[model samples]
Target: MISMDEFIEFVRGGPLGPIKKWGTKWSLWPVHLVTACCGAELAHAFACGYDGERIGALNYGIARQTNLIIVEGAITRKMAKVLRITWEQMPDPKFVIVMGACGLQGGIFWNGYHMVKPSDVVPVDFFIPGCPPTPEALLRGIRQLQFKIETGEAKTSATFPEVPLEAGRKPRVLPKSPKKISKAPAVIVNAPKEVDWEFGQKLVEEIKAKVEAKSVTITGKNRIAVKVESDYIPRAAMRLREMGFDHVKNVNVIDVPNEDKFIVEYHFSSYSVKELMPVIVNVFADIPRENPRVKSLASMFPSADYMEREMHDFFGVIFEGNPWMGRKFLLAPDAPEFPLRKDFKLEEEVYVR
Candidate 1:
């Protein structure tokens, strides 16, 4: 079997060169690899309103059958591997068109630890610049790629004049550090003032009667904050379950490096009881940051399973009894561990002309 480059050369050198180029140009099938928000623009380009098929290019499903890969937006470090794998699976003579500013040099996520340039991962044929490139811009990129295939020469659709900087005016530089993690940021997780809600007050009283809470306060109209010792979280969760707080809405971990502790909170709500639907109960505790481990409430609230895994991924908090503990759930296998922690700093980016 001839290689992709050999086949391309054969077609170009043969008498049917024009025909082969024409056919290939018109039948560009882009595999679906929507990586971020820019995918919305790509969708708009191919949707009924834009009718991208009018140019003979159609969005295909399988990478094996497609000839083009349209990278929709921000390609993170995790997604770069997927992009490379998908590109390798395609047949020879494959093309790539990257859309969005994120694909070029990281765009808004320039300082993000996870952001990766699409060009660094694949041989790009064209780049459409936009936070989320417009549908028209994406289609234009397709047209440019088609022109390159037929003419055997690459051409940009548009060009702009170079702006000159004033003499002795140095280019602005990004700070070496991107984030300023506070050494001792004041964390007011359950600082309660006052709220005039009879039902909330009654609910707080009822919770105090059942659970051994450190403090129970009505933080808002339908919200109650319950402070508890890390060891008593399971008991608090059990009491809340009995009170009809059927599900866990969110599980969060706030890292306080100065205090050497992690503030873990589980926001619970109810769908079984009508009156409790709007009420959100926050059960929280501070655990030692060095060995942040909490008893998993998954046994009581099945809905907390995924949220627990997410918290475990971000803060490296061990949610004991959760089956996915010590394993990556939401992050890529190669992603940095505990990236969301306050001390994990992103690499500084320097722009070059």
Candidate 2:
């Protein structure tokens, strides 16, 4: 029903002129699809300090209701599928804000196999570059997006000389021994000193005695690994806290499809003990994949609460005692199975894109 001249003029007038002149400008709902550590800064940006809501940008968790998406950081191959799907689910004339240095080009994880560029996944409106950019910087990025949409000008285009992909470069051969290895001038050398922790060994001994596990091996100087029954994790975790191991570092659940067992580890460490310093003690167990249910030690270590939730989100391993384990998938709702597990093939997964 629309004519060509009007269509041409509308295109020239840009997105904000007719459809989003005032109401949408004052209601830029941002969909939060947090992937990495930069999510912390993003939370601050939306929170009281930065108050992104001042400009009418509300951080919404739903995809259908949001016009803008701020991808936090590091979209893994699995998360890339999620990013693409979420982008597609969003309404027409949607905008993407790729936040953090990791979102730009993988940052510290550049060489990582799992990572993918956010720009490649979606048509990015703005990029806020920092490991995890400050809340003010994130707000500035949102403002930039608003400006670009209003003006119909790409704010981030760059002109650079292109290098040939097949440019000839010689590969360096490695030396056989330390004496033969050439020392680079940029490298710094600090003299190694003896580390004598006052109560490290004593704490380890006390903690080891409390666990009824087969073996409590001190792997690194400050790291301990305990092989325990799946049923005894709660008791073991309680005892570790009594021995000054207060905080849980992480709860890692590695799925071994071939072995039909899930390797669940509770990596705990102490913050209060002076001599024990910052030691991580891992209490691990091999749980059956057929019935992947484990005793949740979240009561003993509150930090393990979200970690267990994330583990359940990725591995489908049920923590029997977790209060909120019934919620739909956190990362991948439509994923066929646990993508992080060995058997969930990328080629086999039916992505919305």
Q: In lDDT terms, which candidate is top?
A: 1
As a TM-score, model 2 comes out at: 0.50
Model 2: per-residue Cα lDDT over 1-353, one tens digit each: 78998886676466735565455556789998888898999899888887889987999889988889999988876788888899999986689988888999787877454668889878987888888898988888877777776666657533489987665867556544333323323311112223464455676577667789867665656666788889998999888888778888899987666667888999887789875456877888889999899988787678988889888877889998888686644554544445577556443212241
| Candidate number of the best TM-score | 1
Model 2, position 230, has a per-residue lDDT of 94
Candidate 1: count the clashes. 0
Model 1, TM vs. native: 0.85
Q: Each model's TM-score, in the order given?
A: 0.85, 0.50
Q: Which pairs of residues clash in candidate 1, taking residues 3 or more apart in a chain or in different chains?
A: none
